[model samples]
Target: MNLLVICKASTQIGFGHLIRSRTFVENAIEGNMNLDITLCIIGDSSLKLLLKNPAITFLFYEDENQILLTKSYDAIIFDTINFNKSVFDKIRFNAKKIISLSPVFNLMPFVDICFNRTQYWAEDIEKLTLKKYGGFEYALIQRNCNRIHSIIYKYGLEKRYFNIAISMGGGDAANKTLEVIKQIKNIIEPFTFWIMLGEGYSHSFDEIVNEIRKVKKHEIILAKTNHSMWNVLSNTSLLITTSGITSYEAAYAGLPTITFYDYDNQWFLLKELVDTKLTINGGKFSDNSINNLRNILTDLYHDRSVLYDMHKRSKKQFDNEAANRIINIIKEEVFKT
Candidate 1:
């Protein structure tokens, strides 16, 4: 089987879609699915550093019109933010099966299989012609999910100081990290803040250090773009992050997650989790709801039960074998052996 992983990753888009696609490709190779895969990410050359793999051939497309045309792939998988209708139509010209990963709101009606794993596919699935893999059962877990979650799964929040993490995706183009950190400083107590910055983060590391030095009551640990957030988050009691994969990872590690979304898909995820008591919804940051988010955070700090409920619900929300499920889908649906 020949497969094409078409996705997008940039400083502005962050790395959620790219990371998820990479995880699936990694699992496909490990499982020896008799697959020859090409991971085509539509982004700059910088993304190459983040997706280093010797087994899989990497193709990065920076030019808009230079989208690669494939002829013999058995299937093409899309985990992109915005794939034009013409581009999507062209990719499926020769492929037998077209599979889509969540968030699938935009590409739902256009694919053969909808790995409609999370909140994005729930509302209107009955209308789409795509074969479904809806609900949390198909939620993708990180390949290292077990090891990462084990760091603090059993004994949650075992760290020395009260640790709170602020992560607004890799690009954090909006620079919400400093805003979150500043609000936490007024809590009137000593706490440690671990700020995870992505490669696309525009601020200087020196400036972040200088800001922390002025307020010595709290310590700030900076985890650069390629840093292992799982390790840092495992020690944290709570995480204030963008509504992305990191929030899901935090929940698996048994940490209370508070989320702020910048896009439509993220808002969909926030609504789903918040309704389930799986996360504290800080609402969309783009709505100019910083004060509202602050008020929610303040209330959450005083309410440990709310956080704990979110933690327990988070663990139960996912099965952690999402990659394996996708592999089975390939064997059963695409290959049809």
Candidate 2:
């Protein structure tokens, strides 16, 4: 089988789409399904770093015209907002199956199957799809990265002291990570801090490293281009991150998390986490909300039972086996089509 995946990644949009698509490819191969894969990404750096398979082909395009040059695949999986009906219609001539992973607004009606894991699908769009699968049914893209699992077990994370991970996605578009570090400077003492900044962070790398140096009594480690997030989350006791798929990853690893909302697009995932009490909004870092954050942090530090209970609840909600279930869905939907 040949699969073509269209996606994008950058500092502003982050790397969730690329990461999730990679997970899909990984599981497809592991299922012993002989396959050829091609990735169409917007950025060269993201394409080069994210796609590791030698058999994989890469293409870079900013518009729909590029779709005309591609050969037909058994299926085409799109995970970007940029792919509209025009682009799909151009390629639909040869492609046997058209699948979308978390579409932007459900504008494309011809899609064969729509896979939305977070229940973030729009009601109007859901009604238009030929077939729609919703909920946390297929979000488990982690099983694709075998190296991450090995790293998790090798890191001795299960036996470590309290471990806290701070991740703001592939790009820290709002530059809120440093502010988050400052807010927790005093409170996170005695905790091992693993900070993963997006490769596209706007601030100079030096500036971030300097700030880490200023923090006292905290072991701050910077992570770059490493796929060890699963291992890091597996051993982590708590997490403070932007509300995105990483929150789901933390949940899958059974880590208690505090989430910060960075953009309006992030609200869907944030709403779900907030409703479940799996995450708390660490108020924005602007002057208007800074005081609110200070108070929330103070209160959070004093309430140990609330923190513990949140962690316990998180473990109950997210399952590690989610990847396997996602794989099963692909087989039943896209491949079977």
Candidate 3:
């Protein structure tokens, strides 16, 4: 079986799509079936990451039209919204199966399967002629590394006490991370802060790091890209992150997270998750919200039962077996088609 995954990774878009696509490819190959996987990435950094995997072929394209002229495959999975009807029409006749992962607001007529993890399909499924696999479970990672170690091991350093992780996706579009860090600095005692600065933060990354370092007891570790984010998730006790797929990943790791929903797209989903007790709605980075956040964290640190209950709910929501179920669905729907 030949599978080609098309994904985009940029400072503005973040690395979630590419990361999830890689997870899918990795699991597909682990079946011991004769599978040939290829990745068509949009960004140079994403291409470089794909090149690290010797088992898969890598192709970089400036536009979707370029891919239309290329050789076809058994299955072509699109992880980006850049490809539209014209591009899909070009390849629809060539590929045996066409799957779109996490499409934004639109559906392609040429697409045979749609795997949406954002709960978008529950509203409208009759308009498209495709197999709809929708829900948060689609964001599951194939835990090739030891799940226990991936969650617990950290770079042993004497300064590893009470490390608070602040990750606002790979893009950090609204510059929410910097604001969150600033708020944390106001009320808490100094602790090591692992700041996962994505490629998008390159412009002001140094300045932010330096500013955060001014505090006597804070250490800022900037990570541009990490294949094993689960490792970082496991080592941290408290997380302050944006409400996205990462929120669910943190939950699976049993990490109590405070998610902020500032974007219009994420408002409803964030509200739903918070209402379910899966996560706390740490209001956006604002003057008024800072004090509330400080109070919540202070209280949470002392309440062991509440923390444990939250962790239990999160783990239950993000089951480890989600990957296996996805693979099974692909075999039954995609492969059969």
Candidate 4:
């Protein structure tokens, strides 16, 4: 089966879509040995470093306008966004079946299957004729394939120390990590902050290092995005991140997260997740966000029971089989005889 995955990522756009699409491709190939996949990424070649699947073909384009679908495939999965009508039409004309991972409303009329994890699309789904799946059960979270280090750490909360992780998506274009760290400095608690910086972080490390220096009360650890995130998530008590795919990943890991967003869509998604009581809404990222973050951190610090309850509820919301379920549904729809 020939499958083409279209996704976009950059320093400005962040890498959530790219990572999600890659996860789908990885699981799809593993599920069916005969699956032939071509991943067409609308970003620079630097993004290729994120791909670990050697069995899948890779294609990169600097801009979405350059995409010309001259060849047809059995199915085309779009995890990209912000394309004009003409480009979407060309893509629709070239594919036998279409699946959408991004919440582009324009593609709903033509898509065979659409996956959205937010309830903001509930009304729209009823009006659309396509098969729509939502919630954490359909989240495309990447699996950590490395199990050799399983002996080194236990997969649960740490009672001796409070460990908080901050992972603001892959490209954190807004540099929210720096702002989040700056706010966390006000907290006088003796907790550890595990800061994970992505490969696309073009900001100054010296600034973050300098900020960490001022916070002498707490232990600060700086790490790159090279390690297995699932492992990091399993050990951390709370995650401070943008309201992106990472929040869903945290839910799957049963880690309570405090999420802030920069856009309206993310704000709505954060609200929906907060209603589930598995996540805390940190509001939009702005100049006044530091105060809110500090207060939330203080409250969670004084009362660890909130985090534990969130963890319990979060564990039941999602599972590890998200990739398999999504891929299997796509496979069934595409190959149905």
Best by TM-score: 4
Write the residue-wise lDDT of candidate 2 on 1-337 in tens digits: 6778887777676778877777766666666456667777765454466566675567777544555644777777788756556766677767777777754634457677777667665555756836776665566547622222334433433433346678777777777777766765665325577787655666787877778878886678877644666655665556777766777766555556777775565566567667788777765436555446556645654554565566556655654444456446556665563
How does candidate 3 score on lDDT? 0.65
Residue pair clashes in candidate 1: none
Ranking under TM-score, best-scoring first? 4, 1, 3, 2
Q: Comparing candidate 1 with candidate 2, which one achieves the higher TM-score?
A: 1
Cα lDDT tens digits for candidate 3, 77-99: 78875665676677766677777
Question: What global local distance difference test value does model 4 have?
Answer: 0.77
lDDT of 4 by residue, 1-337 (tens): 7888888889898888888888888877787787778999998888877886777788889987798777888888888665557788767867778888876545577788888776566345468888888776777767662221222222334444588899887778888888888888878766788998887888999999999999877888988874366666566788898888888877766778888888665465676679999899888878787678888887787787788778777756766666678767877887789
Q: Give the poorly placed runs of model 2, Cα more than 4 Å off.
A: 32-36, 55-64, 84-86, 123-130, 144-162, 186-192, 213-219, 283-297, 320-337
Pick by lDDT: 1 or 4, better one:
4
Query: Scored by CA lDDT, what does every candidate get?
Result: 0.72, 0.64, 0.65, 0.77
Poorly placed runs, candidate 4 (over 4 Å)? 105-110, 122-127, 145-161, 335-337
Query: TM-score of model 2 relative to the true fold?
Result: 0.79
- The true-versus-predicted C-alpha distance at residue 42 of model 3, in Å, is 1.7
Candidate 2 global CA lDDT score = 0.64
